[model samples]
Target chain A: MNKYLERLYNGLIKENPTFVLMLGMCPTLAVTSSAINGLGMGLSTTVVLVFSNLLISAFRKVIPDGVRMPAFIVVVASLVTVVQFIMQAYTPSLSDSLGVYIPLIVVNCIILGRAESYASKNPVLPSIFDGLGMGLGFTVGLTLIGLFRELLGAGQIFGFQVLSLSWFTPITIFVMAPGAFLVLACLVAVMNIVRKKMDAKGKPLAAPTGCITGDCAGCGMSATCTGKRTADHTVKTE
Target chain B: MKELLLIAIGSAIVNNVVLSQFLGICPFLGVSKKTETAAGMGGAVVFVITIASFVTALIYKFILANEYLLRKGIDLTYLQTIVFILVIAALVQFVEMFLKKSMPSLYQSLGVYLPLITTNCAVLGVALTNVTKEYNILESVVNGLATAVGFLIAIVLMAGLREKIEYNDIPKPFQGTAIVLVTACLMSIAFMGFSGMI
Candidate 1:
């Protein structure tokens, strides 16, 4: 695989920020109430991620380690603001639907995580590819969750009535907050089954535990989880 | 007073920051393994979010408002994201320092989580939501406090459930986040029953 292509594959499959790594749960669960909303949120986040990664990579040498987190945030936040303005002007409905989430993108773990882990260490081009891959993976994850939720919750796909509402009473819960969790849980479990099958076939899976690598710190399982140390040590102060 | 009470209750329950609004989910999931940790995190979140909300509301009203920024011959509304995030980052840092000095043990317990709070979406979500809702300073503070309290409630409950589930015979795949999420789903459903309360 070409290096850039490798980055893409890594993000989309190996370490997918959404399905694989499970970063940015806020937007993953929140905006994914509908297919269209998920796609909009995904693409908007992609643009921010790509540009922020590019800029951070380009300035990796200049950003001091002590203030790096705040600096990365400023970069990501500025890009988000620009994206917000563009969406507000060009796509009013998306802008409105996404609402506070658009601005909240500033705190999205994927963007900052990519910036800290990949972009700041790598050269510009690969970092861009990394961002693109991760963003696409997130988009795919969100869109799938959204599609499932929207179909069941509203008997609609992208606002078109796919399942007739009269014949099928929409399982409205699928589109609500609870629905997001249920769908995500099922999807991840399914993904785990598939990964386990593949691993049994001698294929390399993304992370250990197939799809869900439970980091103790993030999961508050530090007292019980043995995998806590790796995350804490790898985390840079900036 | 009734309206304020309603707003507080509504945010804490009906429009819960975690169960409904889906903010601060990272911490809600991550720091919620233990009830004690969850409680501490909740307290820390309440402090940070309440302060961030108050400060951001002031910034929005006194500085970032269209009328105020227009005086400088620029709309500057476009700067909202950058400005809000910076305020949150700075504010979290300040709080970390204050806690470290003013209350050593509290700071020690919060420890790494204090810095982590800077990126928690709930802090920024409340600030931005407050702006969007056109809330006054008092309202923003109340909303932030209520939201964090809601977060505290959800996380502590989740931690208790998670601890119990640890002993249960769970399926292999659902052992980690999947089961936790499913549990959260049930909790979310339970919280949905509160939606009509307001």
Candidate 2:
């Protein structure tokens, strides 16, 4: 139970798929024009992710090593189909709003990444928790961005008039493509600043401290007695 | 023919797959570092998208759209995602085999991109979107081709810019992905100028 909780916590905050790892920006940016669309897409993806992870983790051992990727893809595709049908039947509005993004969830690197990294190695219960946690994290992150965009762009939240006034002229760019990039850039910058401040105060940064490439040798944040040795190699060639 | 050509150009340029529709961004950022690699990746996408669109349309119209299937209560629309992925996977396999046998150099240039196209959202998105829009076979094929070309153009341009950025003095923090994203933001903004054009 503790392990499951830890996985959930890790996925939601410490290692968020969107804001932290920065995977699956396509749908993150494309469908986030409105809060409702973002939530719908996020929940749909969560459904697919949770089911696929559970099934994949359960059959991980039985699947041969050589054919693992294809096998995982098959599982994910099937799950996505099921979710699509459910969405079409129950939530037609969300199904229509998400448009192609709902089906495109099958190709999202986050799901495949988790399937390959965690679910394929872990037990079913843990994988389920991981999926739920990561999905929730993605949902939260997307919803926040969507809220920010929708409120500022159209003076509304979830299609409701949240801020209506004669003086309030919505910034149209907030709902545009550039708006997604601007919001994402600001979020990443804020995260980096927060991480840096924590480091300066001698506090442990969230998640395991490591370089983006999973290598410590060339990382700028690493502390080592021999850090000066590779100083030249670490210099940016560009 | 002219209308089709216009649609191809319009989709490829005015409504780009990556910059405009926000499809296939994983490879856009991941593989757009080098011009040669980006071109190869773009070509692989073009190949897969074109083929997948045709095949999926056939499946939707002939099998799924048949009144008999609807009367039998066998709405295969539920199987859209699974079938599209399977078709894409099979198409990618076929292309890889053909390239490996006939054009090893091309295969090597494409490298892992050929298989990666199987998971690219743009390929599947185009296929599924065609079904949603209810485009005829010819229209679907044209849209797929145009969308792939649009993706190719965006990625290639991005690679070119990234290659040039390699020579420029970038800031400490916004050097790699950050700067590229900023550039992409600008590109997307510029592309938005076409929104009212179409």
Top TM-score prediction, candidate number: 1
Q: After superposition, how far is residue B89 of candidate 2 from its true place, in Å?
A: 1.7
DockQ of candidate 1, scored on C-alphas against the true complex (2 decimals): 0.53
In model 1, the Cα lDDT at residue B117 comes to 77
Q: After best superposition, candidate 2 residue B168: deviation in angstroms?
A: 4.0
Clashing pairs for predicted structure model 1, backbone only: A218-B30
lDDT of candidate 2 over A77-174, digit per residue (tens): 88887787798899998888787887788878778778877898899999999999989888987898899999999999989987876879999898
The TM-score, computed over Cα atoms with residue i paired to residue i, of candidate 2 is: 0.86
If you assessed candidate 2 against the hidden native complex, which CAPRI class would it receive?
acceptable
Query: Who wins the DockQ comparison?
Result: 1
Candidate 1 wrong stretches, greater than 4 Å? A208-238, B66-72
DockQ of each: 0.53, 0.30
Which 10 residues in a row give candidate 2 chain B its minimum summed lDDT?
Answer: B170-179
Cα DockQ of the candidate 2 complex: 0.30
Q: Share of real contacts kept by model 1?
A: 0.63
The C-alpha RMSD in Å for every predicted model, in order, reads 3.9, 6.4
